[model samples]
Every structure is written in C-alpha cells, then in structure tokens.
Target: MKLKRTIIISIFFVLMLCGSVLASPSSNNAKRINSTYISATTEETNIRYINDKFEVAPDKQWTIKFNKEVNPLAINTENVQVLDSKGQAVNITLGLSSDGKHVSINPPASKYISGETYSLIIKKSLSNKLNETLPKEVRMKFTIMKDNSNDTGNNVNPVLYEARQGLDKIYNLVKTDKERALVSALRDGVNTKINNPSATIDVNPLKDQYGNLSSDEKSDFKNAILSNFSIGALFEIKSIFE
Candidate 1:
C-alpha cells in the first residue's frame, strides 16, 4: 500500500509540472496597451497619444510595449505599417526587442516631412509567441512638428539597409536555437564583407544553413526579404552564395 501511495504521488507531481509548462496564455495578453507606457491621454478607443500630444519629431522612432512576449516571426510589413496621407505605405523599419515584448518602429532614413501627418497601424494579425493575436487593430495618427532644425536624418544606402533588414528577418524567423546562433555569428561577418574591401565571408556555411531550413521557411524568407532586393544587390548576394 505504501508503494502504491508513492507511485500516485509521483504521478501527481509529474502532472503538476506538465501543467505549469503547458499553461494557458496569460489573461493580460489582451490586445490593449497600458496607457502608462504610452501616455495615451485621450479617451479614443483606438487612437493614442504620446506625452499628451499628437506631435512628434520628424525622425521619430516609436517604441511599443506589450504585456506578452511577441512572436518575432510575426513582425513584418503586413503586420505593422506607417501610411502617408495619400494612403501609401511609408518606408518604415520594424524591430522586435530582445525581450520580444517591445517593437520599435523607425521612420525612413530621409525622415518624415515636417508638418506632415502619418498614421501608425498595428494590425490584428500581429501575434504573440503563443499564436494569440491582438483582439483588434491599433491606429495612431501623429504629425511631425514644424521644426527643421531638429531633424537628424542621415543618408543611409537603401541597398545596404535592405540587406541588413533581411539578415535580421532570418535571425528572428529561424526556429531553432542553433539556427539563431548561426545567423547571429554570420551577421557581423556578412556586414564586414559588405562594407570592407579587404574582408571576406564563407558563403558555404550560409548556403548549407539555407538548405537546412524547411521549405515553408525558405519560401517565407525569399518572399519577405529576398524579393525586395535590387538586381545588383541580388547578384551580389547570389555571388556570395556561389
């Protein structure tokens, strides 16, 4: 009977451990952001403000914090976007923080025009690591303050920027820790090869890494990052692989 009781207790402890590991998503993972983090003074349902105002710097980079860890793979142009008044998609950069709870939306290298209004949109498709999506879409409109002197814009090479963004995408979207580490190591090597005339990187490892990715992931990588590269950039990247 003592042995039977011991066996039952062990089973109970094992179940408890499993329950904790596979627990349901947090209730706080709901679609809304805490006003304390963003300072949304207005009572608007979807519209929010920063510092009780709708005016922002021309080179503003908005940081959004969430209650749950977001899925890096889900961060993309389709999920988060900035639109000009003409309904055109602006060239914005989206970066997921190391903790995965924050996303930084960076404006174009040329910066937003002073006195122009732009809308920041976070769609419902934006999801957390558990695949729980935002309950609704989020939109915020802010105008660039009319002050040309404060503009700190830089002339970033578009091709270089796109290539770096591609590397980031691959790093984020990879599933395994081994793949992520490989990408992390390759990033600086690839950047050095691109910027320094005397530097070179072994593309065989990258080619092997790409070959190891699942077909779906490879397709996503090509569509999301590679398809946007310019012909010259594509050739350069292809040459590296060869």
Candidate 2:
C-alpha cells in the first residue's frame, strides 16, 4: 500500500510539469499579438533618422496605422497634436480612414517652417473603438528640411534672398554654445520669412534668449536681422527683441 501511494504522487507531479510546458508557447504568443495591436507606423517611403530625430520635409504629412480600429471621437487635435520647438501647438488637420485603423496628420495652412524642430504628440487619452487607451503617450521629434522642389515656378522675393544671405553669414559665425542655441531658436521665424514672402511670424519667442546675449552678440544679431529682413520682418523683430 505504501508503494502504491508513492507511484500516485510521482504521477501527479509529472502531470503538473507537462501542463505548464504545454501552456508556455500559448502565453508568449498572446503577448506578441497584443503588442502588434497597440503599435503604430508612419507611411513615409524612405523614413530617415538623425540624432534620434526624424528628418522630414517642410510640408511632410504623417499617416499612422494601428492593428485595431480607433475611436472616432478620439481623433481630434486634443489627442493628436503637433507642437513647435517652443512648445506652442501648431494647428493641424486630422483625417481618419473609413475603417478607423489609420489616421493622417496634415500640416497647417502655412505648413511647417524649414530648419525648425517640432514634436508630434500622441496622448495616452487616445482610445480605440473598445475604449481602451494607449499604455503610454508617444512623442516624436522631427526637424524640417527645405523642400526645393516646392519652390519651382515661384517668383523669388529679392528682400527674402538678401535676408537668407545674411542668415548664412550668421550661421558661419556662430561659435559659442549660447550663440548656437540662440540661432536655433531664431531660425524658425527667420526661415519662414525667407521661404514665404507673405509670412508674418511671431518673433516674440526670441525675446529672452536675445536679452541674454553679450553686447557684441546683440550687435551681430541686429546687423544680421535688421540689415537684411524685409521692412515687415524688421518691424516684428524690432518689436520683440529691441
């Protein structure tokens, strides 16, 4: 009777081990499936990354895809946003696919400015049709590159041409870390002014940085901007920095 009891105990332990072995692969497969459903992708043909930031065209648009259908109500700008380097939100238009598994992020009417960095923010508040939100927020940083192709057949403004020339000189002269940072902050409005003759950008963002510069640095700033920017551009810059 003791020998029979030992045999029964060994059989029970063996059964338990066999059950776990059989269930392991199924558990792993479920996690893999879940990851795909929660992920997203962009539709760019040749996506490129530099210094952990995406290098995109000035007018680039993003098409995000998911394995699960998204809730239509979660498709507004509040859930999906684009913000400039200063953390100011850029107005964007969103288009949802009929199946709701894809959404497109379109740039503003002025599009993005070349030589500026922006962030595309996907909040955790975004939910699917089942009302399940994302596990975390997603933020992507990108820098805009000038799209020469878009300039074709457009008449060049002479004042903009001179302004760009002055900016090129300033770019070559930057040496200190502070100077570089200041130029980077100023590039967005400056680039826009040259790229679009009619564009009137708010230069108020440059105030604090400009105030921190040394006297010589401030003189260079005035010479580069005041001497070259168009009359309208000069007015905005002067009002903000002077």
Model 1 lDDT per residue over 1-242, tens place: 66754443333223212221000011111222223234333224543332212235677788889999999998998999999867899999989889999998888999997545577888889999999998667766654544424324632233433444455555545554444434444544444433342444455555566567777765554443333334455444433333
Give the poorly placed runs of model 1, Cα more than 4 Å off: 1-52, 148-242
lDDT of 1 at 184: 44
lDDT of 2: 0.54
**Against the true structure, what is each candidate's TM-score?**
0.42, 0.42
Check candidate 1 and list the clashing pairs.
none
Ten-residue region with minimum lDDT total, candidate 1: 20-29
As a TM-score, model 1 comes out at 0.42
lDDT of 2 by residue, 1-242 (tens): 66754443333223212221000001101111111112333212332111113235566777778779999999999999999979999999998989899888988999898556688888878899999987667665666654455666655444333333444455445544455445554444445544554555454445556567898876665454433444454333333222
Clash number by candidate, in order: 0, 0
lDDT of model number 1: 0.54
Error of 1 at 4 (Å): 90
Model-by-model lDDT, in order?
A: 0.54, 0.54
